[model samples]
Target chain A: MLDIRQTVEKPRMREKISEFRVGDTVKVSLKIKEIIKEERNKKKGSKEKVTEKEKIYPFQGIVIKRKGGGIRETFTVRKESHGIGVERIFPLHSPIISEIHVLKKGNVKRAKLYYLRDGKKR
Target chain B: MIGLIGKKVGMTQIFSEEGKVIPVTVIKAGPCKVVQKKTKAKDGYDAIQLGFGEVKESRASKPCIGHFKKIGLKPMEILEEIRIEDLSKFKECDEIKVDIFSNSKFVNVQGITKGKGFMGVMKRWGFKGMPASHGTHRKHRHPGSIGQHTDPGRVFKGKKMGGKTGNEKITVKKLSVAGIDLEKNILLVKGSVPGSRGSALFIFSDLNVPVNLQTTQLQAENKPVSVEK
Candidate 1:
């Protein structure tokens, strides 16, 4: 019975997910799609047509919290941008995530590093 | 409506061709056998009774075992009747699988929801309880004011109040079919269905609704092509 549940989620599970825990600094490569509008001057009036383009954006941050299990697992990445703390949660098995590269492993006792959110840089 | 008996496996998320995540509920449907077919002349109604989930003969009653024996099929744990306009396609003891839903776009899933025993009006009917603080004393979750003073002096009928909640038959309509696995008899439905995990569900394809063939076409075309080795 458990095997059937696993089989249901097997297709969505990514094969090459990097192993990382809370307090580990990692770089997440996400595929982002942006619509670019170009003006075409065919007649008297100019018409703007939009086209979609895909691009990869890498977000390097420290792992603050990891929640849920199996294919629904999500991790929160916290990073300081422009002297302000920025946090983003990403689904582990999401196809939008192109790659996850573990940069540095931090020594932490607790499972969730939420203290780092408001506390000093550890 | 053509339908089948199924068990709710669980919920999972799948990625679309556009890389958008879609939450889906997996249901292990059919491989159901036609236990009995009711005709208009005989039973005054047109319906096909399908039996699903194999059970031991010892576990089932003598009459149930005898019924399966009459059909020459194994004892089934659940039996459900599906009313169909055309009954010529099915016969007695004919095996029906998840493939029946292959062409179906949307399905209505019926099941008994999980029981939340003796719930309050706040939880059951989403009633706004008493205000907290500002001289409000210990009546935060109370259902304020049932009746007026002495005019009628009785609570009106069909009033939404605190009572037993859930453990009742509920139908979720127009749930799109995400995917179908014929080999394993698994039907992945987009969005949530009622009932807890491992609960029996009646999944029926709406007869009057038009099929969403465009999504199915996109799903088929988006399959990753394998490289020839």
Candidate 2:
């Protein structure tokens, strides 16, 4: 039988996320909207209207986990910034993601690198 | 009020126009026919009964076949009556499509939740069990102290204990309507509804109903667009 759910979802899922797995280093580019309130003077005088602008925000990290299936899929990316570990989960088919760049492929035995959160082995 | 008989398809996350992720539950709603109408003068109330799904004539009972024949409509699998404030807007045998909610922003969904067979207190009532340490001794996940000492003597009535869970009618009100596919009769609701996949659902539109002012204020602050209490 034809599934109406699949038909409705097919058109929205236009992004084909790159094949990257746990321990692989990648970069994700997201289109973010920011509101810019312009000031007319050096003081708190604002004559100009607030403007909404879109910009590409990039994050480079190692893929730690990939969860879910199909267009509803999400993956976790972890990176070290100034000796602090930062993790972010991105939806695979989200329209906000502009590009996914795979930098290096990694060979690991586990699908999820959650053990890396405990302590730095390297 | 405008409503339809529908079935839950499944749940999925979709992207909003603002580049935000929204979890939605897809529903396949009615193109049902108004099988009968009960007028105020004759029946002492105004109600329109709708028929959903198709069934073979041989599979239906004699009375059901006659009921469909009276309205000149084909046999439908389920018949449900919806009480309404006005009956003049609709006629018997009139088809109610999924587009009835095109102008409506929200809807109330009602369905029978999936049944969990004979669950324990931990899973059913969300009761905190005894401590794992300190000589608890095989008393994990047990509901302690049903009643007080000899003063009360008996367990109080309607205590929060485990019993049959789910499989009961639940209504989730003021769920935002994300999108509607009129051609396929599919409705995309912005949040979760009752029941598992493939369960029967009643979708009541918020066309004439007044919007809750409190929720409209919350929506202005960019909170979740729901008023389900």
True contacts kept of each: 0.57, 0.37
Q: On a 0 to 100 scale, what is the lDDT of residue B45 in model 2?
A: 68
TM-score of 1: 0.85
* Candidate 1 ranges with C-alpha deviation above 4 Å: A42-50, A119-122, B129-144, B148-154, B207-229
Interface RMSD of 1: 1.6
DockQ of 2: 0.35
RMSD of each: 9.3, 7.4
Off by over 4 Å in 2: A15-24, A41-48, A103-110, A113-122, B129-157, B209-229
State the C-alpha lDDT per candidate: 0.87, 0.86
lDDT by residue for model 2 (A1-122), tens: 12777876888886566778888999999999999987786577657879999999999999999998777788999998998999999888888888999999999999999888886676
lDDT for each residue of candidate 1 in B1-229, tens digit (9 for 90 to 100) = 6788999998878878677789899999988889998998999877899999989878999999999899688789999997665789889989888887888788999999999999999988898899998888999999989988788988899988888989999999999999999999999999999899999999987644234433434555896444343
Backbone clashes in model 1, listed as residue pairs: none
Question: Candidate 1 chain A, which ten residues in sequence have the lowest lDDT sum?
Answer: A113-122
TM-score, B chain alone, candidates in order: 0.86, 0.85
